[model samples]
Target: MTPSARDVSGKPQGVRGFSGALWHVATRAPAELFSALEELPPLVVQVLHNRGHAGVECIREFFNEPVLPHDPFLMRDMDKAVSRISQAVRDGERVCIYGDYDVDGISATAMLIETAILLGIDVCSYIPDRVDEGYGLNTEAVEKIVKDGVTLIITADCGTTADEEVALAADAGIDVIVTDHHHADAVPSRATAVLNPNSPDSDYPFTGLSGVGVAYKFVQALAEEYPEKLPYPETFLDLVALGTIADVVPLRDENRGFVIDGLEVLRQGHRAGLRAIGAVAQRPIETVTSSDIGFGIAPRLNAAGRIAHAQLALDLLREESASQAEQQANELDALNTERRQLTEDAVSVARQEVGDDPVVVSVSEKFAPGVVGLAASRLSEEFGVPAFVGTLIDGVVRGSARSPEGFHLAQFLGRHAELFETWGGHARAAGFTLQPVNLPKLRAALVEESRALEGDVFLGPQLHADGRVFPGTISFETFQYLDQLAPWGEGHDQPRLVVENVCVQTARLVGANHLLLTFREVAADIRAIWFQSGQHQADMNPGVRVDVAFRLDLNVYRGETRLQMVVDDVRPSAGERSLKE
Candidate 1:
């Protein structure tokens, strides 16, 4: 019984677990470059080349060498930012760290507060409530902080576009130093110093730093200027890494350095809260990798902000006592569980509401403001189109937007600026608030804009297979060589290989929704598993010939380890026949 390639709606199903994507092998690397990399396997070299690391030096730097941090002062207004922060520390003035309500913002807030405390500066932190205060600086929150006698406000992961809030702070005799990474039309004049790599006037070499990355640079400059006031800058890399990975920044250049070194710091478990969280997640803190941070640690940290006050997460990062850290970790884990359920419900509803329109917009009063972004992200990936999920309360609507590749979310939102009360974000993701009165106009505008895009703009998702490989070639040695590309994420992905013309010797459903199978090719027989792919079980009968896209993995059971293939996609062999029934 070969599986059907179409869904119940008679639409072609995506390969493997992808909702609606086509699977294809990536182009082979240039023969010259492939031959020059004598030390690496052809497949590995092709993967690197396909990802744009074609030159010899580029490959070496990406895999072997660490990217040295650029001069911190190269950022626009870096000098002014450093000088004002120094004066605040020297004069014993009240300082406040203003942040957003996400993992990036929480981590940045925690990092700066920790750095300031080490310097014996009078400092406090504030993260606006996602539902009440919205994003960035709000007038009420700013007034309250100023009224608390805060003389200086240093923003972390936010305030790039807070022109009015910065002006209000100035009117109250408070200075602001903005450290953000979001795209901005122009530097806000009211801020005493703005440290954004994306600013039009910025000459910073790397523009992909996360909000916490920017904060790390500020602390880097601080440590250089006043060595005695701050600890070695490397001590804070763990926080920088968490934010960097969670924010999905490109893992190249300076960002690569941050994650590589930061993972080392994180493995040391110097932060008690992180250690406790790792324990709850069943991940060994001493051997935590980038995937651990992305899947285990970050979700719990972000849960606090989504379901409750972000201060809980900030507290977890700053907690010093082992018992206290354990308590905080448990609370966050519970919140994360709740958040996951809410997100699942929202996605289910959003999927049903999706029409034939190129853009998906789901509005519901039941939607939680904090979880809308998660719902939007799921919709975008599942439908292969831009998505906007909003929660309507009273007459105001707060929404999060996610875009597929080839679309710039920030620019799209900019064109609709007249409809938003507040809006800003990067190329792929953004958030905004608007009145219900503009809903009709916003929908019409998006439809027209989506129609204006190229006809093939949303032609499903694409799965890039590094190259075809024989089942017999998947040995432990090959896996070890590929493991050198550690800390894989957004820009740097785990290698996916195509194993062509293999016969399924046995197939079964396991763990509810997982498809477990044994694939045989020539003299080799290998086990494979496809998670959440039980729906395809009918197609994967014994003796069926198929080509599978998979990632090489090691499975351990009964204290024994063996190689296995984690299936990404599966299709009937193009031109192959099985010898056995």
Candidate 2:
């Protein structure tokens, strides 16, 4: 009997060494099941089942059914939060919305402020400078807000683990309501209410909400009470979608609904700032998709935080004037361009400093604290390891860490809690602050901890394909069927299909490092594009047979729409490999 392709843990351990990856092609659906679902294509069924939506009802709900928002009251401490906020509104107390300096944080801040404004409450927003204050709630900022006569501090996208800061605010006679999604060690007892789904006592069925998602939940609950004040709750879904997609949360359950509905809201061009941002990004707001948010809009919003302060982005979200919104959008676009260059330069330097260690840790004053996370994320992907990138600032080290699939960053950081001044984030991404004296100890501890894991755990990337498709099966109709599964991100990735034994008819270099190729798939000739593969031009000569992993893409040129293959990776055909050897 043959062993299964999956390991004991059921993770796919594919046949290694095809374009430096182990292709984990999913097994085909059972014939009986395929026959039973004859209304749908077999390929769609196979992809859906692979994504854990195997049941017919689950499939239907995922593709067709509407996912309504869950009751925000389901979250523990919601009533307390609402009650305190309501009192502030009633007494006309000064309230400050303190948020982090990321897109999620900014969107959450904007959403809450808009809600408060709609309810005729006195509200102001504060987003700490990323370079100066770092992430999460800070004591100095709290003290300043308190000094400004703020009687209540409503935190969005942050304050989950700010035990000391929350205590400071409480001492200053300021009520604090923490609305965040980051994992917390323990709910800050000092906070008036912690509205995080990741809290241990939380009963919310969908724990995958982003910080903006949580804020939207708060708005939903608040609207229920003050329907006269907050008339249209759905008006804020655009911000919810922006932050939810930008934060890279799982696009499942309620999150899927947020994005699906939010996309509709976004398309309406209701937000002038979003319209300006779309104009700057060269993306039409009416035709924007999830990819547009992830690649085009989110970066510009994040750039304000990364390169300067997040207040610019928060203001943009709240701005109504088209001219002012355009100016703000242009400023953010410029910052994003600068951020990209800084990240590339920092990643290059960090790569040189990183030795052949299981865990890569690079620290230097040269790296900007704001862009260190981007550098760390890139390094993690480049080196196939957990990466910790930090910058030494005023005798303290501020850092960000990004991990691969197997490693849990928050858990790993928690194990060494005493080493840092502060630390908190989700499982895959986290940030921390520590003294310079702990650098050596931290490096040694990480190296020792990483040694316990299997060597192959961080070995290269793994490409998961939805089984295999023959050249003849690739059709516009098939692509349209797959297109029904919209709003893909995080847990629900766009499908990658494998085509075996296709002959390359022609290859030419296009823009930058992109390779334009013509492939003969049986009797059909299809146009395919492989980005950043110009260096592999020699391997794709005419008459060369290769196996390609690609995604179906719709290309429209000169009023004609055609199906094209967006190649991900290519390898010599199985037969050709044997001949070469």
Candidate 3:
């Protein structure tokens, strides 16, 4: 049978994975098209087409060709930002860079600070204490910066929506240059310059830049003024890639260019601190992939802010001494360990708070503000609903929300802005602040609004594969064809293939909750690992005909590299074993 056969319903089937999830396989490429596109792997074309990259030129660039970034000055107020920063440097004024605490914020802070130092300006950085100051510019942090005798304040990863804080700084005789990439309806008017591509007023070519991406653009604009003193933007792509991937921004358009070039810079191991962190994370920095940054390295950087002061992370990024970098890396690794435990404990408690409602709202003082977002993420994933988790701090509730694609958390929060002291984020994820008394109001409103828009409107725990494939085609040869399309993330997810009528040769439980199995589905020798699927072992035993969905990975064992299938889902075949068997 051809792999490209269209199913009766193209939408997610919903509630059918062996793990009690959903799987939505894309339509198959036609048989005639396989012969028409024999030059390229048929599966590759199918996946690209499913993602809407149809034309030849677009596919060629996404497949392998290099993508040059747009001019940095193309962003609105970029020229103004560069001019003001240049004047601050020439006048020998003391400047402070106010930034957030997440990986994107820290990386952007590092890049912008490094740029200011190269221009011979006296620069210091201020990363708000996560627990004390919350996400963005707080009145207390700005007051402290004003007291530090700073004449100019630069922001990275935040400040685009901070009208009050910017005005506070301006009232104290400080010119605030806001450099953020968060979603904003309008830019802060009091700031000397606002540089955010996502701003409604912006006419930049691309709007999906991470906080660090915007910071990189600002650095690029400044570099044009003194190209000799500052290394070209290539010097900081490592930071750009880290922030962009960790922030989970779309890996398309110009972002694709940053990661493609940045991955090469990361392999050079030029930055002492990042190299040290990579060593602690057990990732080979020399061959780091975009996925490595997202899963392994970025968490360690974020842990510094989650469990302790994110300033430690910012310091680690800029540390020049190998010994100091190693010490900080170890500290962050320990914090990440602690953070994992905290998130687990919090999720266990928050699980009880979820009811039969279409949405989830759980609040407690026991939840750490730093890790509430993680718990909210877990709850959202586990229950397939929008999750809101928050902790009570000083009579105020600071929380985070995560939703599926069908639900727009930002718009939902904006419609109920009266309940929040502050709220800003993308459609799927956001952070918010509100009075403790408004908790029930927000909770009731979420459920009311969500139920109104239910029924396949938002993204849920569904697995979307490239297309179906025949058992014979699942081999090392197919893996090699797909691996050429590297640097995948957010918009460009790793391609998944679904195979039907396959039999399991053997299956055994491994590592507490994982399934290690051998499949007789392909002639090539390949092992399958179904992570967290040990519970389904009985149904997937030897001789059981089943269908499986998986992505390909190159697994190295004892110095021998081999193709492996990282299973996403498994279910019984359409019918029982044939009588011929």
Give lDDT tens digits, candidate 2, residues 113-222. Answer: 88888877898888888878878888889889988999999999998888889999999999899999988768888899999999878889899999999999999999
Cα misplacement distance, residue 174 of candidate 3 (Å): 0.5
TM, every model: 0.93, 0.93, 0.94
**Model 1 per-residue lDDT tens digits across residues 1-581:** 11111112332233432234576566556678756877766666777887788797788777677589998989989899889977987899999999988889998999999888888889988899988878899999999998899999999999988898999999999999999999988877889999999888998999999999999999999898889877588999999999999999998889989999999999999999999999898666898888878888899989998999899999988899999999999999999999999998999999898787888898899998779999999888777678889998667899999988877889988998999988899888999889988888887887787777758565345666677777667667667777777678788888888777788888899996998888776334357889878888887889878888888777756666778888877877755423321
**Which pairs clash in model 2?**
none
lDDT of model 3 at residue 161? 85
Question: Residue 47 of model 2: what lDDT?
Answer: 79
- Provide the lowest-lDDT 10-residue window in model 1: 1-10
Order of all candidates by TM-score, from best down to worst? 3, 2, 1
lDDT of each: 0.84, 0.85, 0.85
Instruction: Give the deviation of candidate 2 from the true structure as CA RMSD.
Output: 3.9
Clashing pairs in 3: 4-28, 405-459, 406-457, 406-458, 406-459
After superposing candidate 3 on the true structure, give the runs of residues whose Cα lies further than 4 Å from its correct spot: 1-15, 30-36, 455-460, 576-581
**What are the C-alpha RMSDs, in order, of all predicted structures?**
5.0, 3.9, 2.9
Residue pairs of candidate 1 with colliding backbone atoms: 3-539
- Per-residue lDDT over 1-581 for candidate 3, one digit per residue giving the tens place of the 0 to 100 score: 22232333453344366876677777665555555556676677777777777665556666566688889999998888888977887899999988889999999999888888888989999998888878888899889988898999888899988999888888999999988888877778898998898888888989999999999988888888778877676789989999999999999988988998889998999989989999898777998888789889999999999999998999998999999999999999999999999998899998887677878888899998889999988888877789999999998889999987688888898899999998999888999989988988998998888788875465346677787777777777777777777788898899988887788899999997999878786654788899877889988879988878898888766768888889989866766534323
- Number of colliding residue pairs in each model: 1, 0, 5
